[model samples]
Target chain A: MKLALVLPLLVPLLTAVACILAGASRVAQRALSVLGSGALLAAGLWLLRSVDAGGIQVVQLGNWPAPFGITLVADLFSAIMVAITGFVALCVAVFALANIDPARERFGFHPLYQLLLLGVCGAFLTGDLFNLFVWFEVMLMSSFVLLALGGERPQIEAAVKYLTLNFIASGLFLTALGILYGQFGTLNMADLAVKLRDQPSGVTLSSAMLLFVSFGIKAGVFPLFFWLPASYHTPPVAVSAIFAGLLTKVGVYALIRVFTLIFTADPATTHTLIVVVSVLTMITGVLGAAAQYEIRRVLSFHIISQIGYMTLGLGLFTTAAIAASIFYIVHHIVVKTNLFLIGGAIGHVRGTGELKQLGGLYRDYPWIGLLFLIPAMSLGGIPPLSGFFAKFALVKSALEIPSYWPVVAALAVGLLTLFSMTKIWAEAFWKAEPEGATGGTRGPVPLLMLVPIVAMALLTVAIGFFPGTLLDLATRAAGQLMNPNGYIEAVLGRTP
Target chain B: MPLQLAFSIVLLVRGHNEPGGGFIGGLVAACGIALHGIAFGIPAARRLLRVPPPMLIGTGLLIAALSGLPGLFQGQPFLTGLWGGSVPTLLAGQLKFGTPLLFDVGVYLVVAGIAVHLIFTMAEDQ
Candidate 1:
């Protein structure tokens, strides 16, 4: 079991090293990335099965006993996250193979991509708080390069803003960790959870708020999310897809982990703040999405708005609410990445990601348009799709809490989401081709790229129809989180 | 160029135990790289480094992230430092060695890499 946890982290690191040594060899880089990602995907699936048969599994490092050593715990929730990350990474790699310029093969893109995967996997699997921050830095540093890869004016401008914002966030994370260490004298998350349980007074609450603000900035909640939209669309499409799919969600996952396990006692104060901010996040994000005329920019804003839904679930703080949030997160990652990949393909066929310049794509690329529609509708929460089920579950949970404002906000956000989706559809795919369009020739949409998008679309539909499996997985995960004594006990041995 | 080197040295010396560390130090070093570009040429610097600036940034990040792995097994949070004997290797045993040293090294590489890359790219544009 420990092997399962370590394998995902090690494979990427090893493959990255291998890619570097292989140097300028496209075949070597591709083979190494595929094999590495494939093995991780297999390991993630096997871990999922293991969890379904039993319960959460903990992997304590270096034969160290729990509480003192760093631990990797994979419940159903983490397994799902790992699997999703592996799948998305695999697709991004394939897309890069087809789309990345061969001349630029030696530029270290492949190595960084693999390293980024290691960071993402590590973040999902680790059962400690400080380790989580390290992984966040790992992910951020790689993303900084990817963002500035081409170093165009726009990319540079975007990267500077991105770097500055995240630097501040990392600084906040370090300060929070310092406070947590000072208060509890430990940084192992499981141990912190134990120490937090018996803290004399309001220390836990204040520390928890500090942790929340730190993670919230990464998660892109309303106030701190400005960096996301300002920079996300400036990167190349493949880079955008990976960032769109994985980065912010890692923050959200961290929030869910901490709030449920380490800080479950105070809902009225913490959860209400989450709820209020979530509503504002949703409204502002979708409105931002609606206001965008550029295709990628619209998608970027929607990322923030959809994150609001996921946070809403955590804020509602129920078994059902979390399950729905998990479901929505998975659904969003697939749909959002696919939409970006489609946007990439559109950018390839046409010259720009601006919707005004990207008309009549459906006529030239009917298959691409059809593929785009599935994720778009799913994103809009249309029925009989994964998005619908996720939203339905969350909205139902909100109503159950009988929380009128959140329920209304969730419903309204869904409508705005649909409006934004249609806006992209109308301008990019439906509108007439502009006159004097050169209709420049482009290579056919690469199969490697197409396969991942189609696979994701199929998964979206399949999950919607047979949501029972994912739903059960999410429920068990939420359960493990709610009663995280098992997590703490597994990481650190029982007292006395 | 001499002044830039002096700045880099100043940054590296003040980095430890201060707000400035390898990251800031490396950025300062990059300012030196930029000076080299101004004094010489973009192609000359590129030939000297043998990789683009972005790749350097990528490699720096990799090193920095990898620096945290030891903490995972030490029962410390990721990136948490481990220290052993502080006996000096030189200077009459006045100096100490620690994991923070390794972290500083990682920071050094990252800072230097990013600095060089930024200078190279900016020079290319010019």
Candidate 2:
């Protein structure tokens, strides 16, 4: 169990090192990259099983006890998260084999990719507040490099905006950490959960707001999502797919984890704030998506809108709501990533992502259209697909809370989401090629890229068809999240 | 530059107990190497190191990650510091050999490699 706790982190760190050392041959680096992510996936699965069999697993670094030494904990939520990350990383790594330009690959893409994975897994596994910050920086640094890897004019421009906003967020996060430590004198999350309960509400609310704003920026919630759409489309498709799939979700995860564990003192205030932000986030994201003409930009806006649904679950603060949020997250990660990959494939064949420049994919490559349809419909909440169940649960939870506005906004956003998905379908797939457009003589989408897209699409169908298993797992994770005693007990060895 | 390198080694050895640690030691050593490169040019400094910066970084990371495995093998938590008998050193009094020192050495190499790499890139770009 102890070993399992660290495996997710260790595997990636070692893989990244190996990738760096394998610099002499691009083929070797690619093979190592695939093997490493596969190993991370295996380790993630092992950790999930152990955490499932024997509840939350905790490990103390350097043999120091809890609240003093760094801690790594794997609950069902974190385990599932790590497992899904490995799944996505493996998929993207494979896709990059064919999709990434040789110039980019030669310039250290594999090692940076592994380093990004290392940072992500670290963020999900670390139990210390300050440790989480360090992991976020690691994740950010690699992602920033990945974004600006080729240093094109547009990429450099986007990266600058990304860096400036993220640095501000990081500053706020550090300030919150300083304030929390000043009040509670502990950087351990479990310890803070215990200590924060007795302190006056002033520091608690202030730090909570600070954390919300900081994580909100990361999650791309309302009024702070400008950077996402501006930057996500500038990078290579593989980079965009991973970013769309993982980066903002980490922000949502942090919001859920911190709010559920550390700031339950005044949910009436904090959660209410979350509720407001989520509703606005939903409305704005859908509106933003509706206005986009580019396939990736449209998808990027939807990421923000969907973030609203997950945070809504957090704001409702119920087992059912949180479970729905978890289900939504799991479903969204796969479906969204698959959509991005499909978008990349579309761009690959057509040579442009602009909807006006694209058309008749359904005629030329019927399979690509079929591939795009599954995830696109899934994103739009079409029935029997994963999105429908996820949205249904979230909406049901909201109705039960008797919060009518978020439900109204979610349903309305659902409609808008469907509209934009169809817009892409209509403009990019249904319409005949524009006059004088050079649509001829391009090769079929590479099998390497098609393989991951198909795999993720099938996974989406599987989840849609068999919601019970994932929903049950999500319920258990939510139960663990709602009751902090288990986490506190596991980490501190005493129930708070 | 050679004296500075020796001083960096001293700092690294004394770091486990005192204020001087791998990070500071690495910076000092990198500064010395940067000075050499600045004065004598890139080729001479490359000869002086005898290995590329990226390789140094990879080696350092591998060493650091490997250092943590002993604890896991021993049935303790990962990264648990396990110590061996003290080593009698000339400059620093009896230095205890442990995974921490090995980990520090790894950090030292990585930090130094990164600093020198950045300096080299900046110099080359001009």
TM-score value, chain A, candidate 1: 0.97
lDDT tens per residue, model 2, A1-496: 7888888888888888998888779899999999999999999999999999999999999889998999999899999999999999989999999788889988888999998999899999999989999999999999999999998999999999999999999999999999999988998999999988745488789998999999999999998989999999999999999999999999999999999888998888889989999999999999999999999999999999999999999998999999999999989999999999999988888888999988988899899989998999998999899999999999998889888988989999999999999999999889998877775236789999999998899999999999999999999999999999999999999878
Q: Chain B TM-score for each model? A: 0.71, 0.95
Candidate 2, residues B1-126, lDDT tens digits: the string is 999999998889888888787888989999999989989998889889898899889998998888999988999888889999998889877788899898989989999999998888889888
All DockQ scores: 0.08, 0.91
Misplaced by over 4 Å in model 1 are A198-200, A439-443, B1-126
Candidate 2: C-alpha RMSD to true structure equals 1.2
Docking class of 2: high
Model 1, span A171-284: residue lDDT tens: 877888888888878888877777777453586777778778878888899888999988988877888899999999998999898888778667888898998888899999
lDDT of each: 0.80, 0.92
Highest-scoring model, TM-score: 2
Ten-residue stretch with the least lDDT total in model 2 chain A: A434-443
Please, what is the TM-score per model?
A: 0.82, 0.98
Query: Roughly what TM-score does model 2 have, to 2 decimal places?
Result: 0.98
